[model samples]
Target: MTLYRDQALKALIPHVNDRDIVVAVYQSCFDWLQLNPRDLNYVAVGAMGQASSHGLGLALANPDRRVIVLDGDGSLLMNLGSLVTIANSGVTNLYHFLSANRVYEVNGAHPLPGADQVDFEGFAQSAGYAGSHSFTELDQFTEALPAILTAPGPQFVSMEVMPGDAYPRDYAYIHSAGAREKFRAALTRG
Candidate 1:
């Protein structure tokens, strides 16, 4: 079930805002954020495995924004270069969150390149991400997520979320640049 996804997103609401950034997130997990397009101070690219890189781009673009990259372990393996790039950029406002089920759950949950075989925390630090850790349950994630997100640095946090891909029906999406700008405005002036 997607229950864990909802729980994780709910657990993260206290740390989110228009000034914050979240990229490359799954629409399923993202749908749980309950954000209006008018609140989009960030960008979440489509397709898979681009959250870290996209979040990295936003972090580099606006170092002041608290950039959150909702990554998938499968996706991280797709573009390992992003970790190195983020580390090299020295952007301290980024947090890479990976929901690992050890498979491409979106693409039929098939085994990804490394899937369950890789050590993402080690990978993050070796690539100079500064900090990295893993969580296996919602309670555990909740206890540590805030500290991780607020740590004032770049990190890759992998959580062993329970698996399911039940995305919301008839939800909203930000497809225009103007909409994103308006969202930023709403967030800032409110």
Candidate 2:
């Protein structure tokens, strides 16, 4: 069985404290992270396919802090070139996590082209990421997450996850301009 997205998020949470910035794409990732809310800083990049790039910027700008990219397969496919740039940017604090569920779950469950055949980890390696991993099982994911989060990297972890249940559309509002202002304010307050 594939890892569930919510469980994957839970496994990662313990390792992430308030100082870490989570740049996640779309509703599912944002909503799941909200399950056990804390004063965790997050950016819900409302646009699909933009989380990696946006997270890269934050990682580069804040080299002292860890930046996690909670990306999706469809989003990654849309901006594969960002991987090349990220690999070369020398940002060791960035951890890229792909929720590779194979379908664009938000877009009415549209299956991504070649999603099953794509070697996402290999692509990251080819782009020169210092660490590249793929996990399809929950045990492996749990076992690897701590090290992945703690290790100095431009780490790329591709998780083959099962699609989560539908969330309300209002979940998107968490990253609205006002919310972004609040997120910015929180980061600056630190």
Top lDDT: which candidate number?
Answer: 2
Report the Cα lDDT for candidate 2: 0.82
Candidate 2 error regions (>4 Å): 38-40
If scored against the real structure, what TM-score would every candidate get? 0.80, 0.92
Model 1, 31-131: lDDT tens per residue? 54343332544545455667777777777877877877777777778788888888889899998887776777666768876554788888888998878
Worst 10 residues of 1 by lDDT: 29-38
In model 2, the number of clashes is 0
Per-residue error at 142 for model 2, in Å? Answer: 0.7
For model 2, which pairs clash?
none
Please, what are the lDDT tens digits per residue for candidate 2 over residues 1-190? 7688888877887888788888877655565556645444565565668888988999998998999888988889999999999999999999999988888877788999996799899999999999999998999999988888888889999988886554455554565676677778877877
